[model samples]
Target: MWTEVNNSLHRKFEFKDFSEAFAFMTRVAMIAEKMDHHPRWTNVSNGHQMFLQTVACKNSIQFINRVFAHSNQ
Candidate 1:
């Protein structure tokens, strides 16, 4: 699940390896681009951390819920 802090929706995910992490990023990037919403993210070792907030809405509470639901599947 993701948490909200400082007006941002944040999530941290651990993968099996670097390859899996990058793959997950690729998948997320595609969906994000289609939604016209982008997230702040980082990859370190086998973990990926993401922070999502909408410039238009000033927060990502709604968008994050939708995105997280899709990503979980």
Candidate 2:
């Protein structure tokens, strides 16, 4: 499950390498673009962390929940 932190839904994922981590980000980018919802994220070596909040919506809680559901899949 995604956790609420820093006014967003936060998740951390570990990858085998930078290549794999970037690949995962690319995949997620496509999905995010399709949804018109972008995420704030950081990558370091094989570790990745993401925070999702909808800029278009005033209700961040609901937007975060929707983003969490989509990302968890």
Candidate 3:
């Protein structure tokens, strides 16, 4: 679930591996370019796991849906 903090949206996303994380980030860049809107983001990884931080309601929602569809496979 996404939460609001200090006027910014926040969420915790988990990925199975580094490749999945990188792929999602790449897709986000593409989406942001096409939409002409970008979110502030942060990415952290530990070995094969990934955690992402993003804010921008519309962009975040769209990204989550698209990435969830393609992740872990």
Candidate 4:
């Protein structure tokens, strides 16, 4: 699950293996590129940590975290 911490949305996800984790990151990259909004993330072995902050308007900001469940790829 995602948690809001220090004005950032933070989440940790676990995958079956490094391959699955990498595939998940790749998908996220596509979405980020399309939205023109990138996030800070870290991957190690079978785990991934993501941190994001979303700008809603000129004065409003929301932090959000999306966890991707890995499947056969």
For candidate 2, lDDT tens digit of each residue in 1-73?
A: 5788866788899999999999999998888777777788999999999877766666375654565556655
> What is the Å distance of residue 56 in model 3 from its true position?
12
lDDT of each: 0.77, 0.78, 0.53, 0.68
Instruction: Measure candidate 2: CA RMSD.
Output: 2.1
Q: TM-score for all predictions?
A: 0.79, 0.81, 0.58, 0.74
Instruction: Pull out the clashing pairs in model 2.
Output: none
Q: Which consecutive 10 residues in model 4 have the weakest lDDT in total?
A: 64-73
lDDT of 4 by residue, 3-25 (tens): 76666666898999999999989
Clash count, one per candidate: 0, 0, 0, 0
Q: CA shift at 60, candidate 3, in angstroms?
A: 14
- The regions of model 1 sitting more than 4 angstroms off are 59-73
lDDT of 1 by residue, 1-73 (tens): 7777787777789999999999999998888777777778999979989887776775646755466545644
Least accurate 10 contiguous residues by lDDT in model 3:
46-55
Q: Which ten residues in a row have the lowest lDDT in candidate 1?
A: 64-73
